[model samples]
Target: MSSKREEELLECPICWDSFNIVENVPYILWCGHTLCKTCILSLRWAEVKLPTLPVQLPLFVSCPWCQLLSFRLVWKGNLRFPRKNFFLLWLVESANGNRVRYCPSSSCDHNFVLPSNRSTVSRNGSSSSSEYLHETPRSSPRDRQRTNHSLLGGWRILTLLMNLTAKFPVVIIFMLIVLYVIPASAAILVLYLLITFLFALPSILVLYFSYPILDWLVREIIA
Candidate 1:
C-alpha cells in the first residue's frame, strides 16, 4: 500500500476537516473512496439503486467524487461498508505517534483496535468468525480479467470517438456551430437529448451495475 502524505490525510472529503482515525474512523466504499464515519452516518438517507438479492432494506452509497454508486453494507444499522483502511489507519497512528487516541469520550486516552468478529453480526443473521475485512486479499485472476476486459472495451470505444473528433475537428466544430446557429429553444433541446443519450445513459448503467459488480468482487476476495 502506498503511504499517504500528511497533507492528504488532513483533508476529509465530506466535511473538509482534518479527520482523525479514532472516532472519525475512515470507511471505504466499493469504489475505493474513503470517508469519515461521521460523514457517512449523516448520509443514512442516501438513495440505494441496484440490489441483486432484493433484501428488505438494501443499502447503497453514491460516491460524491466519481458519482459511482456502490453497495452500502450495513452490518447492523451503521454503514459498515467495506473494510476500514487498516493500512491507512496504521500509517496515521505511526505518524501521529503518542498523539492518537481511539476514543474521544474516555478520560483514559489510548489507540483503539478494530472490533472482534464475534462482536459483529453477519449479514446472514448468524455469528461469524470472520470479520468483514479479515484476511480479504484473495481476489481471483479470472474475475479480474473479465472486469479489465469490460473496462478496456469501454476505453477503446472512447478512444475511437476521440480519434474521430481529432481527425474531423472541422466537421465537429461545424456541427456545434450549426446547433447554436438554430433557434435557441431548438438548440437547447437538441443539446439536452444528445448529452442524455451520450453521457447520462451510460453513466447511469455503470452506477446501477456497480453494486453487484463489487459484491462479486468481495466474494472473489473472500474466496
Candidate 2:
C-alpha cells in the first residue's frame, strides 16, 4: 500500500484502532509500535556470544504495544526512499543526525527513543514510572537459523580436523607393519587395509564430530 493508504489502514494491534502512519520513515511492528530502520539495523550490528559461533548479531526485537519480543519487520517498495535507502538498508547513520529509530508514521509522529539501560517499554496499566517494563524476551527466526547453521558447520569442521589427527598414527603403523610382511601376502594385506579404512571412515568421522559437541554440552551444563 502507498504510505498514505497504509497510514489509514494501519491499526494498533493492542488498541485495534486506526492510527496514521508516517511515510518514508520508521516501520511499525505488528503490535502497533514504531521503530526506525536504524534501530533494527543497530540490533543487527551488535555481537552476541554463543556456544557454537564465537559471536553473532542479537537480532531479537521487542514489540512496542505488548512489550513482547518479536522478529523485525522489513520495509520495502516506495515506502523506502532512495536517498536514505543506502543508509537505512545498510545500517548507515541518517544525515538528519538522529541515530535512534523513530516512528515511521509521519501522521502519528511517535518516536521510539530507547533510553540508556532499559531495553523494553511496559504495557501495564500502572501510571508509575517504576511500572514501565524493559528487557523484552529474545526471539528471532534469523537468529535461530544462524545458531543452528553455526553449530552444524562447526561440528563438520571439527570432525575434519579430528579425523586427520586421530588416524595419522594408526595409518603410519599399518604401513610399517605391512612393509615387514611377506611379499606374497602383501597384496592381501593392502586389500584388507583398504577395506578396513573404507568401512571405518564414516563411523570414525561421526564419533569425531559428536564427541566435542557432546563435551561442550556437558561443560555448559556443569558451568
Alpha-carbon lDDT, every model: 0.59, 0.46
Q: Which stretch of 10 consecutive residues in model 2 shows the poorest summed lDDT?
A: 90-99
TM-score of 1: 0.35
Residues 10-79, candidate 2: write the lDDT tens digits: 3333333443224324454433344554443444423445888755334345544455444543466233
What RMSD does each model have against the real structure?
Answer: 31.7, 30.3
Residue-wise lDDT of candidate 1 within 41-108, one digit each (tens)? 66643453466643333466566876655566667766566557564465455446523322133433
Per-candidate TM-scores read 0.35, 0.22
lDDT of 2: 0.46
Badly placed stretches (over 4 Å) of model 2 are: 1-130, 175-223
lDDT of 1: 0.59
Question: Each model's number of backbone clashes?
Answer: 0, 4
Best by lDDT: 1
